[model samples]
Target: MPRFAANLSMLYNEHDFLDRFAAAARDGFKAVEYLFPYAWGAADIARRLADHGLQQVLFNAPPGNWDAGERGIACLPGREAEFRAGFSQALEYAQALGCPRIHVMAGLAPAGADRAMLQKTYESNLAWAADLAAKSGRDVLIEPINTRDIPGFFLNRQDDAHGVITRVGSTNLKVQMDLYHCQIVEGDVAMKIRKWLPTGQVGHIQIAGVPMRHEPDLGELNYAYLFDVIDEVSTQSGWTGWIGCEYRPSRAAQPGATSSGLGWLAQRLQ
Candidate 1:
């Protein structure tokens, strides 16, 4: 069976961020992930996790100046210092929270900049991150976000992510495969899953409705079939990782909308 982790950053918007842990637990989630945990104290979040019996599965390293639209700094030429500091802070939180994975976002590609330079910086940063994370027995993830959702996102294809991981040459480095982005950037998600899952380079997976970024059940892709595919491939490859529910609730205006939209999850578990 595929383990599903509620993406607290996107789901359970009705409740405060800290309270989302309880909401997800009440909805039967055993694990959870989110974009970033910098806003709250790690101890506070840890307390919430303990109270709710939920495990923190994933979260992103700080993206530079989010208010100014800097998605990430890992690929930028002059931001290596900032990136390392941010990642160190993220590691501290991960230790405090007992999370196993941390995602490092590749910043948007600056127009008129050398792509090779950006790739070098990104690989270097990832290499350092992976080395540090390996010492702590944790993994560092790089995701291929779609251009539609995040235009100019340096990493946008599975091949590119895997290629970078190969060059980085660290066992602690892996790809965070978001099926929603995969479907948009490259079709044939099931085939992609089958091809990559067995490689053991895929560290985590995420899902959402294509085109609308809503619940997985309301999308062009049939999640039921995909889940079965995942189950089959996982059984064969022994890939035991959490599938993150990273999508917006269709009924966000209503109370308990996130929980209400989880019928697909219940049906799958049944």
Candidate 2:
């Protein structure tokens, strides 16, 4: 069985942000990840994780003003200085939290902007980020989010992400493969995993049911089979990383309903 990390940003909504660590532990999760941790002090976040004995598997670097619609600043031309500063801040948190990976979100492409310019800035920014992270012995990840969920997101396809990673030519930079987004963007989920896992470019993975982004059991994808495939591939290729449970629970307030729906996850762990 693969180790699963609960995405606190999506799961355990019934609890407050800091309190979600305890909730995840009570619910049988040994690891957790989230969108961002900038709101709280690193010491507080670290204290909560230690209190719950949960590993902080992943968290994104600052995405600029999320409320103002800035998903990330890396790909935004002329924001190189800002992106570097944001990365340094994220690294501080990761080191203090003992977290090993940070997802560097590629900001949205400016409307009618020069495509070539955008890609160049993105590649340069990521290379710089990867170099900085490498010095700290941390890995930088790039996730290809589905455009439907966030229109104009700079990184939206697996191949495109691979191209950027290849161009960056840094071992510290790898793909954060999110199955939910892959299913929506390309649909050959298992094949893609197999293809990428061996390249050693995949640093982390996430899963959610397709079409609804709900519990994996109700999705079009067979997570059970996929998890088995992942184990087999890992054994053969030495790919060891957490498969983040980045899905929203069916009902946050209804304990019975959520627990019943999580049966599929329990079976896999068993």
Candidate 3:
């Protein structure tokens, strides 16, 4: 069976950020993930996790000046120092929270920029992150985000993600595969899952309804069938990882809207 982790960042918006942990636990989620945990102290978040008995599965390293619209700085050349400092802070939180994986966003590409130079910088940064994280038995992840959702994102294809992982040459480095983005950027998500899961390089997976970014059952992709595919592939490959429920609630204004939209998850659990 595929383990599901509620993405607290997107779900349970009716509650305060710290309160979302209890909401997810009330919904029977054993694990949780989010965009970032910087706003709250690690000890505070850790207390919530312990109280709720939910494990922290994944979260992003700080993206530079999110208010100013920077997605990430890993692929940018001049921001290496900033990226290192931010990622180091992320590691401290991961250690405190006992989270195994961290996703490092590949920042947007500059217009008419040198693609080769950008890639070199990206690989160098990732290699360093992997090496640093490996000492602590933690994995560093790179994700291929869709251009439609995040235009000019430096990483946007599975092959490109794997290529970078290969060149970086670190076992601690892995890809965070978001099927929603995969469907938008390239069709045939099942085939991609089959091909990549067995490689042992895919560290985590995320899902949402395509086009709308709503519940898994709301859009084009048939998640039930995909879940079965994941089960089958996982059974054969010995791949055990959490599938993050990263989506927006269709009914945003209603109290318990997030929990009410969880019928798909309930059906699957049966």
Number of clashing pairs per prediction, in order: 0, 0, 0
Greater-TM-score candidate between 2 and 3: 3
Per-residue C-alpha lDDT of model 1 across residues 1-270, encoded as one tens digit per residue: 899999999999999999999999998999999999999999999999999999999999999999999899999999999999999999999999999999999999999899999999999999999999998999999999998888889999999999999999999899999999999999999999999999999999999998899999997999999999999999999999999999999999998899999999999878
TM-scores for all candidates?
A: 0.99, 0.97, 0.99
**Per-residue lDDT tens digits of candidate 2, residues 1-270?**
688998989887767899889988887889999999999999999999999999998999999889999999888888888899999999999999999999999989989999899999999999999999999999999999998999999898899999999999999899999999999999999999889998999999999998898899876999888998999999999998998988877765685444556788778867
| Tens-digit lDDT string for candidate 3 (1-270) | 899999999999999999999999999999999999999999999999999999999999999999999999999999999999999999999999999999999999999999999998999999999999999999999999999999899999999999999988899899999999999999899999999999989999999998899999998999999999999999999999999999999998998999999999999888
Q: Which ten residues in a row have the lowest lDDT in candidate 1?
A: 145-154
Q: lDDT of each model, Cα atoms only?
A: 0.96, 0.91, 0.96
After superposition, candidate 3 runs with Cα above 4 Å error: none
Give the range where candidate 2 is weakest over 10 consecutive residues by summed lDDT: 252-261
lDDT for 171 (candidate 3)? 97
RMSD of each: 0.6, 1.2, 0.6
User: Residue 96 of model 3: what lDDT?
Assistant: 99
